[model samples]
Target chain A: DAGVTQSPTHLIKTRGQHVTLRCSPISGHKSVSWYQQVLGQGPQFIFQYYEKEERGRGNFPDRFSARQFPNYSSELNVNALLLGDSALYLCASSQGRTQYFGPGTRLLVL
Target chain B: GQQVMQIPQYQHVQEGEDFTTYCNSSTTLSNIQWYKQRPGGHPVFLIQLVKSGEVKKQKRLTFQFGEAKKNSSLHITATQTTDVGTYFCAGHGDNNDMRFGAGTRLTVKP
Candidate 1:
């Protein structure tokens, strides 16, 4: 089966702008999670959705929000983006403990 | 707050040498997972260990979950240039929340 997929492989935005990143889970997967990875750092969890409900959230600010669709696709939105938001936004899908990650959306905030 | 930490933030070894990275949790974990991310790439799942004192192997890679469920380790019998990447360990808490460590960056010289 195909792996998790993400959209807008690359994006550039200015501070204060808002941006949305999308993700499509692997076949038959029902949970999707979002993470942010700054250069040279490990991925930090952002949010997790299962069955279209918010299952978990990380230490990220309220400006970071996410939702899952009925089909298991997900979207991550960052409002009032700051230069600190420049990083690779990763999406993962899982059935239980094992998660598969997508290629990630690279965002650059200037 | 839950925290996961990895040791030897960086390692450089010759292709034929052995390498090992460790992950420790501030509290007992329900489960832990390992991932690898090559430079300029997103994370990819390597394995998940849900049972204490469990040891799993894949090729030359061996993963071990501590008997106390508070620590884990990944050891490569013989390093290869292709093994160069950042290795991360993620812990899952009671709420199914995931926390990732800082990761150990590996550099192999062939």
Candidate 2:
């Protein structure tokens, strides 16, 4: 079975612009979570959705938001992007407690 | 909010040497997970510990969870060049909110 998959392997955006990244969870998975990873740092949790419901949220700002679809796919959106927002966005899918990550979408903001 | 801290920030060891990384959380965790991320690549889940004082081993790697569920450790024995990468520890709290440590980057000298 294929692992978690993400779209737009890379992206470039300008300050004040908005961007959206997509993720498709593994088959039979009902939980999707979003994380942002800065250079030389580990990933920071953004949002987690289980069974299409917002189960948890992290310390991210209002500019970041995410949602899960019925099919367990997820989308992460960043508004009014800043240079600090440049990082790799990762999506993970979980069945119980163990999570599988995607290749991630590298976002560069100028 | 939960905080996970890892150290030492980086490690460099000769081939066949042993290496270890520690992770501590500000709050007790429901579970702790280990992941490895290669340079310019996404994270891959290694293992998860749900019970306190749990110990699991995979090949040359051993993972341990503290009795309090507030700390964890990952150790590699007789490391190889292929072990070069960042190791991250992620913790999940009672609400299922996850937090990741800054990661310990390992450089193996062949």
Candidate 3:
């Protein structure tokens, strides 16, 4: 079966702009989580959704938000982007407790 | 808030040498997960340790969970160039919120 898939392999945005990243979970998976990975650092959890409901959230600012759809697909939206927001955004899907990650969307803010 | 810290921010070893990375969490974890991320790539799950003091091995890699469930370790035996990457440990707390360590980047000289 195909693994998790993300859209818009990359993006370039300016400060104060908004961007949306999309993720499609693996088939039969009901949990999707979003993470932000800065250069030379591990991923930081942003939000997690299970069965189309908000399950958990991390210490990210209000500018970052995410939601899962009925089909288990997820979208991460960041508003008023700052240069600090430039990083890789990854989406992961879990069936039980183990998660499978996507290729991730690289975002750059100027 | 739960925090996960990894030691030895970076490691460089000659081929066939052994390497180990340690992870500690401020709070007891429900489970710990290991992931490998190649340069410019996304994280891929390696293994998950749910029970305290559990040990699991895969090929040249061995993973151990501490008896207190607040620390873990990943050891690579006879490191190969293929093992060059950043290894991350993520801790899941009782709320199911996951926090990832800064990661240990491994470089193997072939």
The number of the candidate with the highest DockQ is: 2
- Which lDDT tens digits does candidate 3 get at residues A11-83? 9999999999999999999999999999999998888999989898888899998888888899999999999
C-alpha RMSD (angstroms) for model 3:
0.9
Tens-place lDDT per residue, model 2, A1-110, is 99999999999999999999999999999999999999999998889999889998888899998888889899999999999999999999999989999999999999
Q: Which ten residues in a row have the lowest lDDT in candidate 2 chain B?
A: B91-100
Question: What is the C-alpha DockQ of each candidate?
Answer: 0.82, 0.84, 0.83
Off by over 4 Å in 1: none
Fnat of each prediction?
A: 0.81, 0.86, 0.81
In Å, residue A15's CA in model 3 sits off its true spot by 0.7
Task: Give a tens-digit lDDT track for model 1, residues A4-96.
Answer: 999999999999999999999999999999999999888998999999999998889999999999999999999999999999999999998
Against the reference, the lDDT scores of all candidates come to 0.94, 0.94, 0.94
Q: After aligning candidate 2 to the native by TM-score, how far in Å is the CA of B88 from where it should be?
A: 0.4
User: Residue A48's C-alpha lDDT in candidate 2?
Assistant: 93
Model 1: per-residue Cα lDDT at residue A27: 93
CAPRI grade of model 3: high
- Residue A61, candidate 3: C-alpha displacement in angstroms: 1.3
Candidate 3: stretches off by over 4 Å: none
Instruction: Give the range where candidate 1 chain B is weakest over 10 consecutive residues by summed lDDT.
Output: B91-100
